[model samples]
Target: MKFAHDVIRKPVITERSMEGIADNKYVFEVAPNAGKIEIKKAVEEIFGVKVAKVNTIKLPGKWKRMGVYRGKRPDIKKAVVTLTADSKKIEIFENMM
Candidate 1:
């Protein structure tokens, strides 16, 4: 079993993600192999909040090239977690807004 920290890599702090806070939705970068259930559990365990829904998006890696060499960025998996109506807001994001 993966630890909550392992399942949830980090919070996504872009402008688009920040806008979700007002709707009780938060974005996170999750392990590529993690599923919706795992993400939901991880967020609930780490934040102590009830999760209403979970949506995931997988972005393919992009290829890049240097003068002589070529490489690709690692693929990313993101999860959008929506909290239950009565759940308290996540404090980490509260300070940012």
Candidate 2:
């Protein structure tokens, strides 16, 4: 079994993600098959934050139809993790020049 910090990718940057961060939470798009424990571990290892709680959401594939073709958007798994009150801030956005 994987610890709660090995399957996280990076902090996702979106309007919704920014909103979450403003509320003291961080958002990430995780491996589709990863569980909560793995996600938590990955976040900790990558960001060096103490995870206080983890919430996951599995988005269903969306249908798409076109002329002579039909397919669906890929599904995605997302996680929202809250950090401990005393944990340092994670600088996901840095100056890159």
Candidate 1, pairs of clashing residues: none
> For residues 1-97, could you state the per-residue lDDT of candidate 2 as single tens digits?
6544447655678777776665568888888899887777787787787999999999999999998899999998889888888887777643210
| Residue 32 lDDT in candidate 2 | 86
Residue by residue across 18-55, what tens digits does model 1's lDDT show? Answer: 99998999999999999999999999999999999999
Best-performing candidate as measured by TM-score:
1
Q: Which stretches of candidate 1 lie over 4 Å from their true place?
A: none
Error of 2 at 46 (Å): 1.0
**TM-scores for every predicted model:** 0.97, 0.82
Residue 14 error for model 1, in Å? 0.8
